[model samples]
Target: MPATRTLATREAADLIELTRSLAVNELSPKAAEAEADETFPREVFRMLGRAGLLGLPYPEEYGGGGQPYEVYLQVLEEVAAVWSSVAVGISVHALSCFGLAAYGTAEQKEKWLPGMLGGELLGAYCLSEPHAGSDPAAMRTRAVRDGDHYVLNGAKAWTTHGGYADFYTVMARTSDDRSHGISCFLVQADTPGLAADPPERKMGLTGSATATMHLDDVRVPVGHRLGEEGQGLRVALAGLDSGRLGIAAVATGLAQGAFDLALRYAQEREAFGKPIIEHQGLAFVLADMGAAIESARATTLSAARLKDQGLPFTREASIAKLVATDNAMRVTTDAVQVLGGYGYTRDFPVERYMREAKVMQIFEGTNQIQRMVISRALSRPAKGTITVLSEN
Candidate 1:
């Protein structure tokens, strides 16, 4: 979970209180234990489900919470502040729902969306492959139509909730075409020839099970394929466009949490017969951290609002992801400094936050890739900036 603090909101005060109450009572206490054991907390999700948090940011017609993206992100922020793994679980679940929600037909939605949104049926998104990490065009997972069923055979790497999820949203090559050949499928976990390996040990976010999924001749009905046979790339891209904002939100939450921890620590720890927070040097650092958080929050919210307004936000989303994640890495590292030796050990969460921050910079198309995206968007040059004015 990402660390967050109480925000100013009299309107959501009641709801926020309720959200925090459950998080403190149930999620926070078990978070460290779960990370230590490298175990996924299945029951924790169920608890969130009962509280109607899992369905947030979706329409209420299909068992959703009908909340806005802004509200939903803050909720996620609160959850992450206490426990990042579970917060990431919620993020992945929401990601898995993307293709189905954006591309699924009425029949498909009616048949599958309810249980998925129920919060009990965990979901995972399978797009990254051993060969294809950032490049989806290079994906090798193949899905061939056998009679009325699509037989899939390939492997997906770095799948969160891999072995534990109820279903997976898989992207597979349906034809020889690079971009248009791919198709998305909604596959149940226990389906024959579909296997999720044991979780891979990682440096951080240990409580969220990350593993590889093997699909050896896994067959599914044609109805399960999301959208048109050639529309998988669009579905994947669209989902990712939204998904990146979710990550930005996560990054913001983590940065805020780290700053909060450092701030609290600074106020308590003293040197030279004064609290460390009284030192101009440390206070300036805290000021910088707070400034970054505020900026990150602003950028992230701007991107999300643009998305919710149906504007072209690829560049904006990339900007938010890049800024927020980079901020997290910096904030978390400085948080460790405030805690001194204690921060370096497992006794403090600052170290864990640091580890978690590294991955945020790497994933969602790495901060490097985000820069590439922004550059590409900028290279457009206003459709011909240096217009020659030959007088007529």
Candidate 2:
């Protein structure tokens, strides 16, 4: 069952309807089989690209949908409810495009943005390294400037769409300055010395590929740089603020899917000569699941509203990410319990949902990292509040 949504515009409502229709007709049928086979659904992305769903958050000038972040996240949620791997891929794709879309030079945008937003080129973001996943500032990747190119050498770990993407947004150290040493570049996947290592064998989301990208003497043209020197970290963090909201939307969708499945099963399954939903204990659990999903959705949307209004949303984004993922984990686990023995077996998708929910709490800066971000923000005085520095 789809959750009721109140979109601000008829166009947004139509977009959501289109997304839900496509998800049901095209994605849901193949999701289980592809996941079971651990096959990367490259064609599915292309299909979505053709449907104009790949670039909903981008401007229409670059062949995108020009939708607001709120609408885009709802579309993502719709897709995620049917196929989480695809939904995650969509979010990662948006994240990959963020640097160029937000910081690229006019010439660079004119040259590359169309192809990227049009879906002619798929993108991957290269930032996290094996030893410096959380601490990007400590990354060892180097990009030495040549006459007209910057030769890169390092490996980016846990890259989504790794080998399959056509372009990569790479961040590498260009100087010794810890705070301002990194630079961002748009490197073509076909560039020499740029290759992806074998994909990682993960516990879930197998339908989407994750791998380490190796940049060994890969020369990226000077023009490919997204922003000025030493601005990569800023761009990366900004993108992550938006990316966390995307993950929150995906997690909410996953929880919704699980809850829907459990609700259907519970209403159909019998317990003590009545439907399991007739039991107060089970009913309370369903009620909690419904409440959690709504709360997570509201939190994610609130953060998105802040972003859309061009306000400071980093703290809110982290809060949304933390709350949504944690609630998803709970909702999915309860869903499994609702199905009892069937949920434990592969015959039902609740088991897979449980596995998929585990990773949501781990990625996009783990929930622990999110808590740190939130706490640090809380330590500061509120925007309008005056702080009196009095020694205790």
Best by lDDT: 2
Which residue pairs collide, candidate 2? Answer: none
lDDT by residue for model 2 (6-101), tens: 998999999998899999999999999999999999999999998898899999998889998989999989998888999999999999999999
Model-by-model lDDT, in order? 0.85, 0.92
Model 1 residue 168 lDDT?
97
How close to the true structure is residue 181 of candidate 1, measured as C-alpha lDDT?
Answer: 94
Clashes of each: 7, 0
TM-score of each candidate? 0.94, 0.97
Worst 10 residues of 2 by lDDT: 382-391
By summed lDDT, the worst window of 10 consecutive residues in model 1 runs over 382-391
Q: lDDT tens digits, residues 9-66, model 1? A: 5645556677778777988789888788888899999879877878777778898877
